[model samples]
Target: MKGLKKKRKWIILGAAAAAVVLISIIGASMNGAEVESAVVDKGQVIKLIKESGTVEAENTVVIAAKNSGEIRKVLVEEGDRVTAGSKLMESEVTSAQMDIKSLQSDLAGLQAQYNQAKNLADKNKTLYEQGALSYEDYNASNTAAKQLSAQISSLSYTIKSYEESSGAAGVTAPINGTVTEVFIKAGETVTAGASLFEISDLSNIYVKVDLIAEDADLVQVGDPVKVYNEDAGFTDENCKVRKIHVKAQEKMSDLGINQKRVTIEIALSQSTALRLGSNLDIEISVDQRENAVRVSDKAVFELENKDYVYVVSDGKAVLREVELGLEGEDFIEVLSGLEEGDVIILSPEDEIQEGTKVKV
Candidate 1:
């Protein structure tokens, strides 16, 4: 019985010892706060201005009707590749043709009368000089000749104008490009200067972006840019800013917010796979650092216009003031007060403060 009692005592003591060990472990773990952390590192960080842009042809040309005419045939459709001066359509310019003929006939009659009047004027001038003609007769002959000459000149201009209108019967492509839009078809009566076709040189394409004034201020001509279309799986990193507008204009955003925007143009390469008028994305590298001590932006916070980060040291959260340099998308450049291997608490909570226990 004494032996069994001693065994029971030993078992109870063993259980008590195990319970005390577990309690000590629980207390130790609860002493420090649970937090996410990251280590500071040195790497390249690029400050990029991301914006949606539209693909445009650098050499886009709009073909318009030279004169009023009825479309008799449309030989080219949208997406047709055409060369300069290629016949695109034909029109029936019957009215213009008839008008040209009438003007020409009138011009011929006026020329005949002008010739006769000029000859008479020349003879009258000689006769007046010889005292055979009066001043009134000479002046009348000269006036008649002037009137006929003016009429002939006016009729010639009319004939030239009608002939130009008649020449509009054949509409042609003015440049070498792919037809992007066709506004008129057969049997359509179009007025002079009406838009007929829109052609774009696909090989010479560019990206156009209207950046907000704040973003535009950081951009300049010759800045490196990356053009991409995520949905289409197209990307071209060899693009550069080609132009910047001199003025900013007020524009409405997609969400109806008013913003002042400046236009920027990016030049793409000849091998670019962008389609005209398609929306693509562009990232401009405005600033960069080849080797910068960087930390995740989440670890950084602002206090009274000063930047700070919660650095972990000696198992405690240490609030350290840091001088920031360049701001990047995912990380920020740490200028001072942070080392390459220092550990920091990511997204430190409001309840966390200096000297607070932190468990990584």
Candidate 2:
């Protein structure tokens, strides 16, 4: 009985081994899906902020009319070079001058009335004190004097405003620059604060970028930059951050996402005659880390504030948690949970999961 039982146990063990081999063959045949992958490597990872901007003059002045008047003389045209205090245009101020004179005359009349009323008020007060006038009469005289004084003051203010304003005067150049725009022609009627001309010193031109707020905090003045215009086929190898605006502005991107952006100026070493608003691409190396355990960024994904990468091993994909450091354009620095020689799936597909069979 012992011999028979032992022989039966061996037979059962042999049958189980055959079943295991058959299952292995079936699984291997079923998992023939192809996937792309990359190897974890140790190298320098450069964090870069890429932005596109336009070439803009360093200092631009928009000259607007100070008052509403008919343009009498346009002294400068587009492309005309001008200096500080130079006249750019002249507006007819005869009507404004006339209005000032009329206001002054009205003020003079009010002043005379105020004097008469004040003198009458003084006489009434004296009479009331000596029991020569009634209380109602004295009060009325005082009120009249006050009203006249207010009227005179108001008219005086009107005259002063006219005198202080640059009504019908010549608009002068505010700085040494070339006139880049002309909006008014002689005999054109312009309103107060109408834009007349734009002056700019092209020699002070530089690349202006609106950096996304996420990257703006990492950027600083004097940061190195590589600027190029792919369309114009021009590149400035030596460029650095010149200025950063104090405030952030909200702009809508082509994808219809609202983004907070800050303006940064780049001082260019290249000379190009491209006009203002010329587009250019810039690559700013914001930071760098050497000898970091890094992998292709395509291999990483985020879930619930934690990062995950699909790691490949023995024709299977396993999800691994990783702590990330500096993330660059192509690679991400792995601070923990991964090491060199690890194979990771790139551009992980939606169906990939833990223990999923993969053919890399």
Candidate 3:
């Protein structure tokens, strides 16, 4: 009986030793798995989309001559400030003067002939009434007098037209603005309707932006915009959309592919140091979300037309499909599937798979 009891105690000790070894092996395996799931955290990530465009004047004018003539004088130079009725240029006055003189001479000759015919017709009418001259002679004299009067009247009108045109021999600014361009030089001959200057009213300016049709819906007549000229500086000027073109402009080379682009005219709300015709890079905020959960753009992934992010949960990566909204520069608004305290991979490795162990 003593021998049997000692044997039973030895068997109990062996069983206890086996159980301790099993527990050690399981703990070692769990530790190895935990190490494999480690992940490295990168810096903050932001989501943004970028586009480019240019600036333009809201009111621009090309001053041209009304009649062909030699440029006698230029009253203004490029970059000169001018106002309405300010003379910008002048055409040769010699030709205008000669034209006026010739018309006057023609009028004088017609008037002398008309007077002589009137006297001749009056004398013939008196003679005919007293049977001293023939009816045919009186009629011929009357007709001659009337024809000469008509000729005099026509010449007078020609003279008046020349006078009016001569008054406008000098080109004048139509609006209060600055002369931005001077296309004519003194002694240069310009044709009728040739552009001689470009005047712009810079008090109110417009930034013209050509935007793709897909993005045009976000723009409206009153939406706010930001404009900047890198050549000028980093500070951006605030502006408001004044107009949105509905027609899609075609690309110059490819007629087949009609690029749906609309011109957005943005009015500057504040004065800017930028000059007229200066090319500007523009950014228009289509939407905004305040105090919303957001993440870096790279963190979000697209698959099968759905958006998602890999969130680190319990030392493992879990694919969290998210609804996105109000995307801006370097950041995207997380509409769903994320909380403020959630840890998401900045830039997930391509090899990262769903349910993979990760340490962040």
Indicate which candidate wins on lDDT: 1
Can you give the TM-score per candidate against the true fold?
0.74, 0.64, 0.65
Q: Is candidate 1 or candidate 3 better by TM-score?
A: 1
* Tens-digit lDDT track of model 1 for 1-360: 999999999999999999999998777556888899999999988999999999888798887787787899999999999998898988885676766767777788888888999999999999999999999999999999999988888877767665556563366777899999999989999988999999898878888999999999999899999988879989889899999999999999999999999999998854766667999899999999978999999999999999999999999999999999999988999999999999999999887899988889
Winner by TM-score: 1
Q: How much is 303 displaced in model 3, in angstroms?
A: 2.5
Candidate 1's error at 265, in angstroms?
1.1
Error of 1 at 151 (Å): 15
Order the numbered candidates by TM-score, best leading: 1, 3, 2
For candidate 2, list the clashing residue pairs, or say none: none
lDDT of 3 at 233: 70
What lDDT tens digits, residue by residue, belong to model 2 across residues 195-247?
99999998788988998887899998888899987777888878999899989
Off by over 4 Å in 1: 1-31, 66-69, 101-169
- The models' CA-based lDDT, in order, is 0.89, 0.87, 0.74
